[model samples]
Target: MTPVNPESSTLYVQSLATGVQVLRAFNTQRASMSLPEIASAVGISKSAAQRFAFTLEALGMLKKDSQSKRYSLSSANLESGYQYLQCHPLLERANPYLLDLNQRTGETVNLAEPADDCMVYIGRFSSLARLIAHVPIGQRIPMFCASTGRAYLSSLSDDAAREILERSDRVRYTPQTVTDVDALLTLVQQAREEGFACCHDQFYRGDLALAVPIWDAAGNAVAGLNLSVSSTSFTVKRAINKFVPLMLETARLISTTPPNPTALRPFRTEPRGPKEAG
Candidate 1:
């Protein structure tokens, strides 16, 4: 006959839950986390957090800090994500198309997906001029402040889209940033009708971006494709008229293409180093 201790059982459960929460905090933002930082953010006891973190470290899922004695995520998570991408034939096919668009347009082109209340640029090609990328790959940008985000939101149900808007603080990145929830909702509806979204100095300070949703065979846009140009390069009307159509065509080509057979990868699945993490 065996009996379990109630207090011990509760302790084990809290430890497990706290460990997962600790891991969640290591996204694109603030990738590397110190023990104290993690404990504060997870709102867990220091001893409990340390035990959980050491467990993850033993599992080869967290790298320890020597000087600061903190911790960061390891590379093991990338294998799981890479395996999932291997199954998604669409993302592979879409790559060559993205590359071609970059070559032809002479501007940066990006593909993004909804993440929390924002959109993360999953794939992108850079232009001749270097840009200040405040939101890098695996990072998030607000739905109201990014044309790519708005394009993705515009394709979703109104109730669902409105919920995202309501949750976001709509921090004013620039004077052009749309912080009004009602007005942002209206803009999303208009994007749906126009089949694209355009915004100037919204997501980026000097960048003007035109984004459109890429519809799959099932008629759902699982992601948004965006063409971005600096204000110095062109005006809004010219970008819409000259580049929008090409962008749509390139999206379809990439969307319909076959999965990559090679293993070369660029996306980040684990916590990034301090230098790259914003």
Candidate 2:
């Protein structure tokens, strides 16, 4: 991740920031948005939004519908993410293991990285089960509530983890979501000691997940690997006992894989979107 000095603002480009914000306004929920809606969502004037939209459309990153006069992301927009995954050595090495784990458990598996106060899903393998949650890649979940986030936090120093949790929005997503700072700190400490983290219905009701942090050659927690199952299919205890070993093994395998000769840059922090269950 590129380090930023918050005190320095001269290097920041406001136009570029606004352009990126305009692009992020398009999502599964808001697949297409009119210029007015975009302006409101991005907190910009309609003329500025129109300029951003026009520039994006001209660049082939967005397309405007003639009938509704709304703009939507185009296939070209996916190129950036495609290039990211293609160059990420960790995801490249972990793909086969994630596939194997998915087949063995018949459950969803996720590869995620901590970004700011959330964990973003960068890679995922879907379960064959008929009743699984639809968690698309690029979905973000709060660090305090997600198993993957907790696992990554566990690998950090207590003070670092506490700082992140303090900055988190902490909006209660479910009854199980832990908002208390002290309680969450305890969970992080426990995960650090146990080498894994488990969350039951915290991010979403009826969803259960287990995760372990993936370390890099330098011993930094580069990513987190998660196994997600439905509460109806297995108890939390049962899921942890059955999958924790596999998760740890997969994390170790990813950690030991050498970095790509042409290293990939880490993902940028974008505008926050709706949270999804991991």
Task: Please give the RMSD to the true structure for each candidate, in Å.
Answer: 10.6, 8.0
User: Residue 25: error of model 2 in Å?
Assistant: 2.7
lDDT of 2 by residue, 183-262 (tens): 88888876786777778789878888888888788768888899988889886667767887777667767787532221
**Lowest-scoring 10 consecutive residues by lDDT in candidate 1?**
259-268
Badly placed stretches (over 4 Å) of model 1 are: 1-17, 26-34, 75-87, 130-135, 255-278
State each candidate's clash count.
2, 0
Task: Identify the runs in model 2 with alpha carbons over 4 angstroms from their true place.
Answer: 1-11, 257-278
Query: What TM-scores do the predictions have?
Result: 0.78, 0.85
